[model samples]
Target: MTTTDRRPMYWEEFSPDSARAGAELACLRRGVGREPGNVPEMWRFHRVRISDHEARTGAPSASLTAEHAALTLFAVHQQSQRKSMHRQGMGLGASLRLLRQSEKYKKNPQALNARVNALATSADVPELAYHLRGLITQLRGIGQPLDYTSLFYDVLAWHSPEGQERTRRRWGAQYYDWAESKAKQPQTD
Candidate 1:
């Protein structure tokens, strides 16, 4: 089926109750830092989907690139974890925000902030992926989860200038808006 006809099966769909979920995640993990189509092992998991997507478009698939990046990052983030890392509605910005708020980083946030700034300032996919690997590692250290599906779409959008601006704006809002909303909440005795 084409990408438009069916959404790619992400980690969230695999129930944690089954071993298949862990096995699939393990397959994806092997692709970390490797170029798409280079890892023959991961091809079974992602190749057919990408081929279907490309077939429909009749051109190189941007979504496939984004999918590879997001999948690899998810594998990293989910490493050694019992629960699924793909939390719905948890975007990259929100995940980073949680990392920023973690007690470990609360005392000294400069390094965390610097990493985030680097990610924000990345000019292209390769640069973004490089920066993301570091941040994703940090998030894993803190046991934070993110929505890989949302991240896939965001990364795809990042391919175009207009989409990149919009994605950046949305991420900024997600990152900074959380504090404002929390501050506005009514205090109770």
Candidate 2:
């Protein structure tokens, strides 16, 4: 049975069978055409906002389009990432806010991160963080949050059934980090 304060399952934790199971699960998740169906409708609707606005108001004729938005979002995301790679955690809050803005894109934060992790396996963790940071930055510039509640760490734990394992791993690390920091604090007695 799993304990309440169980640790994250890293490469070190998997048994032979469990490792195979994990690989199988990863394959299933990565299979062609496997899209997350429960992604919020608001995200879908947000994509249409630019086109919808263009149609109704005839603005940004030369400056805005879906592609523009996507690029701008990417650029902002990249900028934020540069900041993060320097060991700055303060930008996390702002970066998350940006992601919330770009929620309209086909992929949400979790999906995007998973994709990046899969495709960019050789990339350093700091590099990945930079990418995510850029995404958040772009989203925020356009007036959106990185969507903490909908895309938060805690939400991951309870939301997707498949995500639970990964979420657990991530949360375990986060909790451990927090606990370690707390443990190092001096008592004021």
TM-score of each: 0.82, 0.21
Candidate 2 Cα misplacement greater than 4 A, ranges: 1-123, 147-189
For candidate 2, lDDT tens digit of each residue in 9-95? 221122324424433324322321212222222122122224576558655322122222322232243232212111123223333
Give the least accurate 10-residue stretch of model 2, judged by summed lDDT.
33-42
lDDT of 1 by residue, 87-140 (tens): 889988998888888997888878787888888888988788889999988888
Candidate number with greatest TM-score: 1
lDDT of 2 at 49: 24
lDDT of 2 at 23: 39
